[model samples]
Target: MTRKYIDCREFPSEMNCTVAISADSEKELLEAAVQHAVTIHHHADSPELRAQLVTLFHEGTPPTEAPRTA
Candidate 1:
């Protein structure tokens, strides 16, 4: 199966977090993403948040460099 990933830089945040996470499966990706969100981003853990996180997941590993901002 293809790897799954979550790129923090894709989301708008005050910190402009650049952390990126990848996993072999969706379940693992979701768990790590959730933990990172709650701990670093101060997000509340819930089914709703979990659902939202799933939407942010993408196939393959995250990019090595941050997107160029204009």
Candidate 2:
């Protein structure tokens, strides 16, 4: 199966978090991303959150580091 990932730096947040999450499957990636969002970002877990995250899913593994931001 193709790997998938989600990068926090893609979204602008108060913390400017640099975390990048990846998994061998979409299900795994979603679960881990949800946990990170709820615990680290203090976001409420809900269907809406999950939907939004789905849109952010990226194919393949994340880069070794987050892209540089100005």
Candidate 3:
């Protein structure tokens, strides 16, 4: 399976967070992302949050900044 990542910089937030997390497996990435969201961003951990985060996953390493739409 391909490595997956989620970059916080890509999302809008009050802190303008710059964290990016990656893992070899989706399960690992999801757990880490959930923890980061709950602890650092003070977001509630729930099914909805997990669903949203899953949609945000990208293959391989995260870009320094969010890629621009063409």
Candidates in order have lDDT scores of: 0.91, 0.91, 0.90
Give the candidate order by descending TM-score.
1, 2, 3
Task: Please count the clashing residue pairs in each candidate, in the order shown.
Answer: 0, 0, 0
User: How do all models score by TM-score?
Assistant: 0.90, 0.89, 0.87
Q: Root-mean-square deviation of each candidate, in angstroms?
A: 1.7, 1.7, 2.0
TM match of model 3 to true structure: 0.87
lDDT of 3 by residue, 1-70 (tens): 8999998877677887888999999999999999999999988999999999999999999887675533
Work out candidate 3's RMSD over C-alphas. 2.0
Off by over 4 Å in 2: 68-70
After superposing candidate 1 on the true structure, give the runs of residues whose Cα lies further than 4 Å from its correct spot: 68-70
Backbone clash tally (model 1): 0
Which parts of model 3 have CA positions greater than 4 angstroms off? Answer: 65-70
